[model samples]
Target chain A: MAGTWIFVEQRDGNIRKVTYEMLSEAKKFGDEVAAVVFGKGVEALAPEFAKYGADKVYVVEDDVFANYNTGAYVAQMVAMINEFKPNAVLFAHTFNGRDFGSRLAQKLQLGLATDAIAVELSAGKGLFTRAIYAGKALAKVEVAGEPVLGTIRPGVCEVGDVSGAGAVVKPAVAATAADVYQTVKSFVPTVSARPELTEADVVVSGGRGCKGPDGIKLVEQLADLLGAAVGGSRASIDSGWLGHELQVGQTGKVVNPNLYVAAGISGAIQHLAGMSSSKFIAAINTDTEAPIFNVSDFGVVADLFKVIPTLVSELKK
Target chain B: MKVLVCVKQTFDTEAKIELKDGKIADAGINLIINPYDEVAVEGAIQLKEKGVAKEIVVVAAGSDKAMDAIRTALAMGADRGVLVQQDTAADEFARAVALADAIKAENPDIVLAGHVAADDGSSQVPTRVAEILGFPHINVITSIEVAGGKATCSSEADGGTQVTEVSLPAVISSQVSWNEPRYPSMKGIMAAKKKPVATVAAAAADNKVKIVEFSMPPAKAAGIKIEDEPEVCATKLAEWMKNTVKVELK
Candidate 1:
């Protein structure tokens, strides 16, 4: 049955949690939620989608599908969309999803919206609420067209366990060189024991108050202690203490973690735009009048170097 | 090799966003070249400096003000520019179509733009242009090197960096850290005024989506602050994080 479709995101055959979250979200709309997963040897995870309320699982497997290639994934998705004619398609706003969604929308000339914090479906059309001007404001966009396409921001929607029809359908299609415009040579990952910043439930971030890498290391130690991700303001990033990927701001990644801990961050407007939507914000700063304190649910006027270590030591108790 | 750089003028990241009558009030707002697009312009200029590219053409498609974006690119060291005059507001698809229409005539070996615009933040026009032109597209790339009719690029991926080899005549979008943009020299500023910028009318397409409403995010709930010794504050903060925030600690 043609209905809402969720693009399953996976890395090395392990399905990302966002896919389940999207499926759970699609189920709430009272539509037939089918998950389309791509990659080689990912059939075993098909049933897992069912547990999260996927009515059908369309698996496209090929050696070339293991790593994400924009054109290849776009072509496969276009073929599937044409065949199934789903009214709506949802994807996680991860790197692959954002890249693939744009190209797919162009190839098909479909109305597509990206980075939606909230979404609703009416008469097969998608109404998406997305942050504009880098979270300074929110806009409600009416993506009204056939096969409405959109990408959901991470951590906004809750994961649900509603069961659905768990039929697996392997599409008899393969991606060749012509479908791929670029060849992936290698993937080098940053060495980090913490969670991915955007998808993390808890984020511990450093700012200018973080004097140097040593201070950031303390932040990282706390992140590791609590299984949270580490983030930094543009100041710390520009200071060369952290990578750009860890930056959270208007130019950087916007995070909506459940709990965001800021150490030495002054919470400038640009910086606040990124993490203001967080469920609960806490700040540790030497300045009691820091703007970060204004947005924080709890604040402490103390030096992070002393407070963070003490907090770590005490939490260990 | 020839490079074509696309740029757009948008509000600075710090500009206040004020919506009036279902639109953003443009009164006294400072618009500059999108920070990311400046990176793309810098990348193209670097390619030109290396003698690998003979010509760098900057292109922009928007209102007349978009010419400022092209002029800024020109002052930064591009050889020429193309301004596709699109006075009416359109979706990313239409803008891409117009841009691709302009790009097709140039047929450069490479096209570059920002990973995403600061205004709409759609991140579509360049990729869509690539699709329309039947070229490979890579976005938010940190570095690129060209040789033997191919581009080797390192792009930002979730949790990792993906290195890819794209064929020539590809589309590349730049991340902020790609390169530092240079200030236009006085000589460059005078030279940009003399730079040739061709103007063309935009192609038409139906608008795709309508913004129903714009609203500010809800205000943050009030919070508590504690000023005390590190030991006491740490104890209270940890307790607040675990009990009040209800997040896991250790």
Candidate 2:
């Protein structure tokens, strides 16, 4: 019987939503699903995993695991994989997940697929589908080696509740301090009530045509009105009009939301690769010739400064 | 300190991608240094200008055309270049293995690369290489400061910036905000021709992952276009959202 493992990512003991999504997806493979949670005070979150089809929960709690240190996390993960001997491992394609997942694949000499939108078992092997060429194309990949590793893009898979055996297993791995070669000096979290760009169902994005920070504020205002996430194109990011975390492009976060609104954004191919998969796309641009209109479900040719304020008022009414 | 920067040649960001027979059609396509890698190169150059580095070496694994990108790096002030000639079919794992072998030979104090290749969008090769070499890596670094054999960096995370400090001999993948790259001047271009770019055969490495097939995403169908006054367009959009998209509006 195949065994599947999900790396349950958490911060300050709060489990990330993607972990539940991965757990739910892993159960569909008809394999015994186990969740590996590594952080101080994470054992309390095991019941949450069990609610999402995790048959067993492995907890590695230590002070060194309090922060995200690459060496520490990879070492523990490698140890866990070796002991569990799972045929497949899944992770969320977040900053920490991508970093640790890629390293784990190398350390174990296993096949890895990152940012996968879908995964299926074919011929007794895991097949992954991921976007390539800046979202212009999709590639189906087959992992050749054992212990297939894949990172699922956030918000791609649906989260479901499937109860499983609420068994907890504490794997006896060496309790050594994480061999951190780096130090995390500090972190400045963005204070916002809006949804995360990658996880939001509705996203409102702006581009160079936003002109400046004031224009981005308008975009934010609309997002606030709709209770949506705010994102920016590469041009806006490069111009320092938005934070890097808000960038949505080929090189940035790939978001597939229920609704995507592009305001003052002339769609570059790089930008299109990130949001083209969104269910409903609406483009607002002054330039009629902007390439974004080609793929938008609704196109409005007008000044965004005038259009956005009017839209906000209309939504209010 | 010696710095090694890994760069890749990719299609221009604005170029329209066309696929023919399940493969990218690259004929007559304009290729430039990957934008993020250019930022990495600029980071290395800034370190050199700050007297933190004795030399900077730029490396890539690609065909002869990739040499142009290496020369571009040299013109932008890299000391030398190395090209690992390999087939384009190599997956990210194989490429990372080949690059790790080459990087181990150089033994530089620090290694730099882009967070992700715009063409493939895998964002795995550099991290894989770092793991293979047993080196700690930090990705999406927005800014870096080197002093006293330790580097302090600010990297982008989900809705936050992580300030990290790592010792020398580590690998860092740069984000777009790291630094602005300089263009090649006439003198720099002429000098770049004189700089040595050594070509070596890529090491034979097994591909752990293979792409079985490639196809373009389904084309989005044409939608409604409204060229009217702002108020009318706004009302139309609101109505469409309420009726068609059915999104929750508070």
Per-model TM-score, in order, reads: 0.97, 0.96
Candidate 1 per-residue lDDT over residues A1-317, each given as its tens digit = 35888999898887888888898988988878899998988898988999999999999998778788887788788877777789898888887888888788888887678889899986658899999888889989999777898989888889985988879988867567578878889988778878899989999999999999899989988998888999999999999999899999988989999999999999988899889999999899999888899899989999999999988987777
Candidate 1 at A285: error in angstroms? 1.4
lDDT by candidate, in order shown: 0.88, 0.88
Runs in model 1 with CA error above 4 Å? Answer: none
lDDT of 2 by residue, A73-190 (tens): 8888877767777888888898899888898888887778988989985323789998877688889999855578889898888888697885888876554664877789998877
C-alpha DockQ of every model: 0.77, 0.76
Each candidate's B-chain TM-score, in sequence, is 0.96, 0.97
Candidate 2 Cα outliers beyond 4 Å, as residue runs: A122-124
Best by DockQ, which number? 1
For model 2, the DockQ equals 0.76
Who wins the TM-score comparison? Answer: 1
Per-residue CA lDDT of model 1 for B106-223, tens digit only, reads: 9999999998888777777788889889999887899999999999999898889989898989999998988889999989989999999999988776667777888888877889
